[model samples]
Target: MTGQKPVTIVAIGTLDTKLVEYLYLRSQILEADPSINVILIDAGRAAIQHEAITVSQPEVLKASSASDGSLESLPRGEVVATMIDGAKRVIGDLVNEGKVHGVIALGGSGGTSIAAATMRELPLTLPKLIVSTVASGDTSSYVAESDITMMYSVVDIAGLNDVLRAVITNAAVAIAGMARGYAVRCATPTGSEVRKKCVAVTMFGVTTPAVTVARQRLEEMGFEVYVFHATGAGGRSMERLLREGRLDGVLDLTTTELADELVGGVMSANEERLTIAAKTGVPQIVSVGALDMVNFGPKDTVPEKFRDRKFFEHNPSVTLMRTTSNECRELGKRIASRLRANCVDASAIEVWLPLKGISAIAVQGQAFYDNEADGALFDAIKAGLDGSGIAVKEVDADINDPKWAESIARRLVELVNSKSKG
Candidate 1:
């Protein structure tokens, strides 16, 4: 501990409204480990003058090209937005410069929004924790694809009481410990480490067998496989990693999130789901695994318009609606268009269509089986990539067939090798 670098923890909040609370939080952090360095960032609208405030409100406004006058003249939403932008820039610079090991913030909705926005920009390796009044409900918007930890504040962050103190003290201690570990990890050398070539694979409950066999085969071929669940957040996370150049290849076996996006389902990953790998020139083998179903919350939650659609109750809380032939065709066109439009080199991409079935429930007598829909999807993809250099192959077996999964894995290995050679 004597020779180790000091762990620096950043405490961010609106000082104008919550100066006392921030002071207490900082005190608790330093009390836990006096050697830990704490930097308090004031994101308040008003410029608060205090030596303890490492980054002032004025500095934040300047980072976002705003002034103190803008706070009064601008709408509350715009003011918060400007402050968030400023705080993000300030925090981003600190993280880049290795001045921040961990970040923690306490706030209501407004404070949480500012802090969450700033913290989300930082690296996932850095510890980010937020104690917020709205943490008990759905926090997908706040934590989206980031590893930011959210803690529920039992009471509002108005003023510190016994409950608030206990919560703040616990949060402080947790962050301090995390910061110490993070600092140690940062100091550790990693340049000499030998890591296997990593591949990102997408999966769904309906396509688990295919992904499982493929993942195993990939591992056997000496590639490290990261399997993402194909949920909205999971797909987004995988795409982010791909853009960051963390993945060497992709085996996109479960493109279900695309179905969710196309059908206005709850788990949509947006329109950018399949474009990152193409833009990055990462060799990818795409398939229509689980494209047969659009995810919904429950049987009752299925929209009134889709009441007549084929439905599979995955569980009491999870429902799957079969994609119509028209929807399948559109999804195919979207996937092919994204790949073709974004790919720097079409040779790096391959589309594999399973002829017999795409998902577990789509084979033979299962609930979602529909040859017409699957055919529409395949035809659209082929048509969309008609002149493109990308290769489109059809496998006679169902997606989960062991040999088919193995072939996909082996082809990805070839693609990766071919890219390296090129």
Candidate 2:
């Protein structure tokens, strides 16, 4: 304990409005662990002077490069944006310096937004907790893809009541404990002397077998595999990790999210999907798995225009619509264009086509079976990559066939090996 670095916990809030609450929270944190260094950051719009405030609102604004005048003069939206930017900068610096072990915040919508934005900028392993009045509602905007823990405040975060006090105390004590444990973990060295190569694999329910086979093979080859579902959020998360340079190789076997993006499916991962690996030049083995259908929430949720389109009720909540030949062609072109325009090294990328079927339901006699559509997709991809150096291979088997899956996995291993050797 004598030579140990003090565990640091950052508490962010709108001090001008919740000064009493923040002070009480700080007291509780320090009381829980006196050795924990707690830094209170004021992210309020108005300037406030308080001895307990470690970082003032002006300092936050200055960090965001918005220190032209008092925060009170800025519009509410602009102020919140500036505060988020400033807090991220401040907290990011602390993290870079290894001073932040944990982060905790309590607030209403504005406070939650600022604190959550800042906390999201920190590492996923670092502990982040937020007590919010709106935690019970849809928190997708607030939490996003980060691992920030959110607890609903039974009452408002205004003047502290018995319930509010209990929540704040619990949050403070929890963060302190987490910070101490995080500090200890950071100090401890991992048992493995050599870090294993990590691969990011994309999957969907339709392509589970393929991903499962590939994942097992990668692990057997002493590689760590992160399998991300092809849902919108999952795809976005995988792309974020790829951009952060957290993965060595990619097995993009389930590209159904692109069909969702090309069509009007709810599971679209947006335009940025599939571009990161190409731009970053990570060894990738891509396939046309699960591109035969677009996803919808329910049978009724399918648009009236698509009423005549082929449909499969995956479940009571999910409906899958078969993609038309035109959509498939467009989707293929998009994928090829993205890779061709962004790929830094063509040798590191390979596209595999499962000629028999791209998804579980696209085989012969299946609900989504459509030879014309599949042919359109395959042809478009080949045409788009005509002059590109990227390799394109075709296999006469379903995407989920064990043998085909194993072959794709082996090819990925070969690519990674070649990259390492080069």
Candidate 3:
């Protein structure tokens, strides 16, 4: 089930246009490891004749359940969508049938889009790489919430040339190494090697003190604590793990990403930050740990409307803009809605508020201290959950105070134990 299985690397591209380049890539992979098995998936829709076709366009269309003529007759968007669907189905079957160990795809904009979509359907631990002509730009679309690795094809992925050969050769070797390594390291553990009870905690620079203390205490109580930075990607990763059943409980302390998501900041985690734990019915302790500020990159990056607002220069490259009372209220209401939808078992959820301050710069005499904003957030949450039966507690201590951190750790332990009993 592990390395005992031979590594099979699936190479996907438009063999119609790049048959010579595809052959060169295959040669490089064989040069790296002669035993490595390679499968060619032709995802092109054009009716170009090519002799080196392994998995033909007709096969892709059949797997995707699209009419053979749709690729040529349909609009370009529809054509690409159908091809992507076909690629996903084919890749899924290959993995389930033990024919695919890793996936490597190379192409331009259209090819990259199709390849990335296919790679995203694979498991998180699978070795998925995309060598693309558009890798250096905004890759959020290509790697939305997946573990697909992308490499910039310095030169275009055109026909074989001296420069193209070097890029494709390097990519081939990299994928080969990735496939071999994944096969060995990704086996499920057993016996005493099994993991301890896991807990997910959120962290940001402003809330590090509290999170660090809570994490240490949780580990002391025989639990494995994973602290995800409150960046967009970090929150997404945490949610992904929760959905995968990797954690037993959650300590969603640093919810500052909500502010960014609501107010158009750079580090927003969308609206799904606290939804997964609630949906899974996992025991959770939520807090407004760092909701006082929205994250932005550089002082100049702040929008014109926010330029006059209270701003803290977090570092040379980062700026923290204080959220307004209206924004806090909106955030609180949004959070409550998520909790109501997902946390159906009210007894399993607890919302804690730090009365003194929410983050490092929000305490009295600090840069982000805004009593009106803080009060609005607190009142909004209380009103939103007036009859929801979820417990809301207020602490007079600052969020980073050792006493507050200790209390949070203890409460989470209690909730985890109670859920385990149920």
TM-score for candidate 2, please give it: 0.95
Error of 2 at 171 (Å): 2.7
CA RMSD for every model? 1.4, 1.8, 2.3
Candidate 1 local lDDT, residue 132? 93
Of the pair 2 and 3, which is ahead by lDDT? 2
Model 1, 1-422: lDDT tens digits are 66777889999999999999999999999999999899999998788888899988888888885555458788889989999989999998998888999999999999999999998788877899999999999999999988899999899998999999999999999999999999898888789878799999999888888888899989988899999998899999899898778899999989999999989888889777999999989999999999999999968888999998899999998899999999999999998899999989888999999999999999989999999999999999999999999999998999999999989999999999898788
C-alpha TM-scores of all predictions: 0.97, 0.95, 0.93
Q: Could you tell me which residue pairs clash in candidate 1?
A: none
Worst 10 residues of 3 by lDDT: 45-54
lDDT per model vs. reference: 0.91, 0.90, 0.87
Question: Native-vs-model 3 lDDT?
Answer: 0.87
List the lowest-lDDT window of 10 residues for candidate 1: 65-74
- Checking candidate 3 for backbone clashes, the offending pairs are none
Better of 1 and 2 by lDDT: 1
Residues 1-422, model 3: lDDT tens digits: 33477788999887777777888888899999988888888888774555655678778878896556456669888888888989889889998886777899889999998999999878788889988899999998899778898989888887677888888888899999999888766454565775688999999999999999999999999999988998888898889988888889899999988998999999888767889888888899999988999889989878898778999999989899999999999989988888988886898899999999999999999999999999999999988888898999989988999889989988999999899899
Find the 10 residues in a row with the least total lDDT in model 2.
65-74
Q: What value does the lDDT take at residue 108 in candidate 1?
A: 91
Instruction: Order the numbered candidates by lDDT, best leading.
Output: 1, 2, 3
